[model samples]
Target: MGYGELIIRSYDPQYDRTRVEDFERKCEVGPAKRVFLFTDTLGDPICRIRNSPIYKMLVAELGNQLVGVIQGSIKLVTVHKPPNDLAKVGYILGLRVSSLYRRRGIGSSLVIKLEEWFIANDVDYAYMATEKDNKASVKLFVDRLSYVKFQTPTILVNPVSHRMSRISSNVELAKLKVEEAEAIYRKFMSSTEFFPIDIGNILRNKLSLGTWAAYPRGESWSGVPSSWAMLSVWNSGELFKLRLGNAPLSCLMYTKSSRLIEKLVPCVKLPCIPDFFRPFGFYFIYGVYREGPLSGKLVRTLCRFVHNMASKSKDCKVIVTEVGGSDTSRLHIPHWKSLSCPEDLWCIKALKNEKKNSLHELTKTPPTRALFVDPREV
Candidate 1:
């Protein structure tokens, strides 16, 4: 029990509707940050989360008042420890505590319970991401709890109104079958962190627009992807249509007039809205990766093509992707740097004894510069 006798228990839709809405209302991020990930098939806020069998949700209640919430999902991932070990890791997210409930130890209780679940599920590692500048979050996870500030990733967003860059003649942007997509992912993501063991499910999900692979025109599809990039596009219109969660004045104006207005106004910096707060008509691009010599150029081409395709839809106003801060791929993305939020921090800790002792070794390793944080998982 925490302050005011707080209680930690499973989330029940029937009783937690008002509480859930209140929690969602208090939070300031979206796509994943705005929308709760563990909702039911139809995305009914009150229904139980059935996104996957491995997912679970928890809520903290005090005096019959819901105050905090957290969710966890297990993924069998391959870590590059040496030859690559297939380890089950838990991705913890959707954490929110009402402003009235801070300093009550509700958050700590939730993480402890989730880490227990990870251990029971044979999860070796546990991790979650937050805005890097949130001092409260950083202190709670890193200083108060036994966690390490692992990786910082930039969340890239692009307004899709402009024309897209054309792919080079030698590069072919082809839409591939689920089988082809999975084959490429299995190879390119073998040494990646938090890689899904059941990538097939991801590729075939109902929301997935489709899986795409980019390669040289001369190459034939087969075992390994030589100079390549792959990504799955998710239609983000539903979430926005249901809950128009963006600021009213989101734009990409870079005219001389705009500069003059900014110069005249000392308080106003370049306007870049948050991803979840942006208005409707955007594609949340996920599971993106590039491999090869000209991978950067090729990947950029593929991304532009996707943006162009999405732009044709009246509902799609922007294209978004979250890439690790240290990932080489971020170099190629033409994102609104002034508008994007601060880097997202993914703080981590270990649950199993084998992983707990090896935490030091894991930290010493080259550090996972890039890993596919499936947008859907968020």
Candidate 2:
């Protein structure tokens, strides 16, 4: 059938089972595997939608068959804290189209529909990402729809063994209490790009742990300043790591959820956001202070702590982080070599009252004041 014959619609409760099965069969290759599996296993995509400040899901249908699906949500980019006068920017994620329906403008139509949804929801700008090698997707987003490439950050996955190798004799690591880690996290924020985090809220919502400095033997300090790591374990048995560092820097937290039974077999129970949501592994929530002589060392130390922890845990396999597209000073780190690239797919659309320049600049210009907010918030 021709592209015009296809119909697009939002996810419906009635179509759950059939659509999930269809998606599983269609998404056998490419980046669509996880998304397909998520939908199939969950049985209902709508249930996984995250209750964020703004949320949306759109799908394309060809007659009675499902042809394409697009899901997106709105988030406050607290990193920039743009003036309230400016329109709120939202992110578009979990967009997928079936392979059989290629070159038919189905994806583009879904994007346009999503843009309308954004406008109705009072969102000013929207953004999405695709792999650098996926020229077809790049063209669909960047060329046809005019979605600019915002931040392309590299994605890295470390086998458990790789994380273990980084634990050298020079450093000592220990788990810290949440309260102790929060105080140190506040200090770390003075130099990094991070949204203000609520320690209490984090402890309540998910499984979490903190790891901190043991104080190296040569340092003759009477009291050690608090420095640590923080990790949030999701329902899916995936661990998300974040770091907080002071002068004597260290990892802040490490958290992992235990698996649950599904159909008599153990299965990782991921956080219950909407099926359309994209799942990120780990986050680099804090950055090093540029002015300090030890800033570079601090960054390296934080990376090492993460590497060490991941090496020990077989379940924690991937580390996803975001760095400022504009920041050049602390760009190079030895451990970051395995990361894919520093660019991500950010889908965007212009609004009627919104200044084109604002949308244009966000997409074209490299962000200078970028901070890593927890993806859970997105």
lDDT values, one for every candidate: 0.69, 0.48
List the candidate 1 regions with Cα displacement exceeding 4 Å. Answer: 1-4, 30-43, 46-50, 82-84, 162-170, 216-226, 236-281, 368-370
Worst 10 residues of 1 by lDDT: 34-43
Which lDDT tens digits does candidate 1 get at residues 285-341?
777787789788877887888878876886676677887677888778767864465
| Candidate 2 stretches greater than 4 Å from native | 1-5, 21-25, 28-51, 79-87, 166-204, 207-291, 326-339, 345-347, 361-366
lDDT of 2 by residue, 1-378 (tens): 344476666666575556754574445323431222232323445332453445667778776667777777665443323322334555665567777877878888988888888778776666665666667778887788866665655443222233143444544445556665556545544233223334344433443333344334344223552332233322222322211112111111111221222224434433211111233233232322232343344445555666566546544444444445554423533333423354444455666544577656555655544344344432
| Residue 36, candidate 1: alpha-carbon lDDT | 32
Best TM-score among the predictions, by candidate number: 1
Note the clash tally of each candidate. Answer: 9, 37
